[model samples]
Target: MQSFRERLQAFNKCVCDGARLMVGQGDYGTYVAHIAKTHPDQAPMTEREFFRNRENARFGVGNSSGFRCC
Candidate 1:
């Protein structure tokens, strides 16, 4: 059985993740885990690179299509 402290920590983590999702923020931890699981041979991007890439992808930055989502 899990101790109270352990259970509380886990619940807190879930709440935090849910909050981030509700705010449309990507979780860096989830990205890292996905890369590790699906692309074991490739290194995951640094957090800064990940966020920059996500932002560019979201807003169509540096794309010739010339469309911005926001």
Candidate 2:
């Protein structure tokens, strides 16, 4: 039996996660969970590294021109 506060917190997390997905962002905590569950022998990246990798993936690698054009 979950307490009211716990239920509310879970609901809040779901809402926030949905909004984040709508904005093309990945949750670091979810990434950690996946790595833990699927690859017990592997290590997950730190939060900063995760975001940097995500950014690089989304915007392509920067070039000598200093900008990424689609």
Candidate 3:
């Protein structure tokens, strides 16, 4: 089984790629707002804000190992 770090890395990569595509497709604002609402901690941010938050490592993507309501 993959470790938490591995899972987090995969998730982050996917999100990053998705965000980039959205921005390139001219849906930056929409994508950012949608992610902010759906996944607040992983919400899209400006490049500056992204670097600042990333440097601080201050965000959570929720605990995915456990089951939740459907």
Could you tell me the lDDT of residue 28 within candidate 3?
Answer: 46
lDDT of 1: 0.84
* Best of the candidates, TM-score: 2
Off by over 4 Å in 3: 25-70
RMSD after CA superposition, every candidate: 2.8, 3.5, 15.2
- By descending TM-score, how would the candidates be arranged? 2, 1, 3
Q: Which 10-residue span in candidate 1 carries the lowest summed lDDT?
A: 17-26
* lDDT for position 30 in model 3: 62
Better of 1 and 3 by lDDT: 1
lDDT of 2 by residue, 2-57 (tens): 99999999999999999866655689999999999999999999999988887775
Better candidate by TM-score, 2 or 3: 2
Better of 2 and 3 by lDDT: 2
Which residue pairs clash within candidate 1?
Answer: none
Candidate 3, residues 23-43, lDDT tens digits: the string is 432334565778889998884
RMSD of 3: 15.2
